[model samples]
Target: MEDLKVNDGIVSETLPGSPPAGLESYGFDQKDTKRLLRKMDWHIIPFMSLIYLLCFLDRTNIGNARLDHLEQDLNLHGLQYNDCLAILFPFYIAAEIPSNMMMKRTRPSIWLTFIMFFWSVSMVGQGFVTNYSGLMATRVFLGVFEGGLFPGVNFYISQWYRRDECGLRMAMFFSAATLAGAFGGILARGIAEMSGVGGRAAWSWIFILEGLLSVVVSLGAYWAIYDYPDTATFLSPKERHEVQTRLREDTGHLSTEFDFKYVRQALTDWKIYIHMLICMAGFCPIYSFALFLPTIIKGMGYTANDAQLMSVPPYVCACFFTILASYYADKYRRRGVFLMGFQIIAIVGFALLVSSGNTAVQYTGTVFAAIGIYPQIPLGMAWNSGNIGGSLKRATGIAMQVMGGNCGGIIASYVYISRDGPRFITGHSILIGFVR
Candidate 1:
């Protein structure tokens, strides 16, 4: 080893990104780091994935609830259902950057717990809303609270893992969104069957039961979720030092301290807007697909109940392929290049959906769209956060990109309006443009 140095017995290779030649000099080795990585994965990734799954489930369950007659009960008029979904984005988009900045000051466990509690409240309240205005009011609060979590998650992960290691971890976290899509269909199918139970409609049950589940999980999260590696109670003092040391060397500058300089760095970096453009491409199609998959499936001649059941397979395929893509992306250490290739897959999927009238063809398009749409989220997340240096800069950039993506969601909500249904050329064709 070339002149090794150790801080608290944590060491790295002589050059960052080189093989770890000097780890053993400080009583650390490949095996020790591997063990540490495994511990970190267990302590962090799955719980993050679980809460995010619930977060996504709560947001997109409106689609499922719609199938259970939300519109009929509310007497939603033309474009009103779409407006309800659209109502979420303004509060959601506006909150992204500020929420991340707020999280910077608070322990993530406390901050995340606080938001989760309120969003769950908003969700459960949706079940009790009796009219269009009531429904709209609940969605506004839902948007405000749910906005913080994703950017907070990206910031949290960036702090926990180095750039090279982030792709797979982000993939694992984002795969929960796909699983929620698959799982939501099954849950909705079951819940929708509970119509008229407890004097509640099936649509109401979708929100109430799911929201209550989230409420319980949120309370549990405060206890279960760990803070930084340094403060984590689960790790030994030695391992905590080791984890922090590894993280310090990964960045060009240690991101432990926040500065207004880094905040300005993120905002003024013009390249981030390019990343935001790509984010727009990735998120627009995804929100549309999630919010309307059942509607689209039902448009394909299936009953509402059957539509709920059938939405599963595409999302299952998406989860599998998303994990597969991230593994290879991490292994190869290429992001933008691999992403362009996958974008083509989604463009093809949208083309099939837009051009074909065949039911089998349309369903195939959905699978292609899901596989293509889902992977882009993690790919975009990892690519954006990995390139940004400071924790604060990463926080701002990721939130900015996500905010731009929310703009896509606004577009998505309106594109699938009922007038375009049965062969929503306007929707799928617009989606084709988005993926491209």
Candidate 2:
């Protein structure tokens, strides 16, 4: 490894600037470092939350659009919609490693902004698609752009935050999924209600408005987000030294190193497969809401508008529980038990949804499913983040986790077939069993 001096510490990779002083080397004083890391958390969390919120909103607006006539207009049948959903994963898997590799070499600011812009364009293009083929192509393009986001954010957070702080920070970031789950429903309903104002379908309006929103947010992220601790031009040299020393102290290991061999080892290891298995098992329930909740809400004898509006409440409930769960998980510093506990709650919720005939009861189950499963996601990510070290390896590990969980995205897309609507027993059963 190449050694570069910054402040009083030796970094594995050097930045191109004059060094600052007062950065303690590895084995620094613990209390001072802890205080610095807490300040760093304030800088990191909001930036990550914004990106992930857009990432989730873009991925999931499809569920809201389905409530109107997206399926009917395109003449989709049986597994055709599911098939469109499935196509994204192959491209997502293909792009995962390469995107992270490129992000590592290039600055995250440029690459991540480029990615957001592409997805925003794809989201806008989705507004114009007239057929299943066009929608399919757009979804694929969306996947190619967005596949890097979660992994990239994961890698970025790991770079600055310490092991313990990561749990809460990651929780706040991943809770964007829950927030999108909550608020996207409201936003979609408002947008969908704009139908015929300019001679367009509600679904088209949904796409156009959301796409434009993403485009605006991407512009701000380019200015607000930083690459790494030492390279942050916005922070003064003293602040950079404080960040470097603080993170190293928090992790109990040097953070400046980039290790490719560890990444290869992470890829080949059997334990990582177990981690993948856990991700697959849980991610389905989470994604089913993203891809199918609007349809499921419509099955409950409500108008399209009512269903869209109703979708908001369940996700809002999810946001509350996700935050609550994260706060407690961080307070206790426990992960596996928390994850398993939520899975069991989710299993019960799915069971209730499948077996209950009452619409209100089933809706209650929907709320539980979101609450039970969503919070565990960030907790799981923080758990995995703490276990990995070095920039390249951490990036690869996070990418693997995201790809594994998202593999369930394809399964989720297919699980709720139109034929199985009204009583989506097969899909719910599969989701319930998978969580176990």
The number of clashing residue pairs in each candidate reads 0, 1
Tens-digit per-residue lDDT, 1-436, candidate 1: 3221211111211224434433432246878877888999999999999999999999999999989989999999999999999999999999898899888878899999999999999999999999999999999999999999988898898888876678889889999998998999999999987999999999999999999999999989998888898899988999888777767766755465667787898888776788788888899999999999999999999999999999999999999989889878766666766687789889989889988999999999999989888899888777777667777888898899898888899998987989988889889998888888
Cα lDDT for residue 64, model 2?
A: 88
Model 2 clashing residue pairs (backbone): 7-20
Whole-model lDDT, candidate 1?
A: 0.86
Compute each candidate's TM-score over C-alphas: 0.94, 0.89
Model 2 CA lDDT for position 217: 88
Q: Where does candidate 2 stray beyond 4 Å? A: 1-38, 233-236, 250-259
Top-lDDT structure, candidate number: 1
Question: What's the lDDT for all of these models?
Answer: 0.86, 0.77
Per-residue lDDT for 185-274 in model 2, tens only?
Answer: 888878876888787789888888889988988887787778888988766787687778767655445444455776686687555566
Worst 10 residues of 2 by lDDT: 7-16
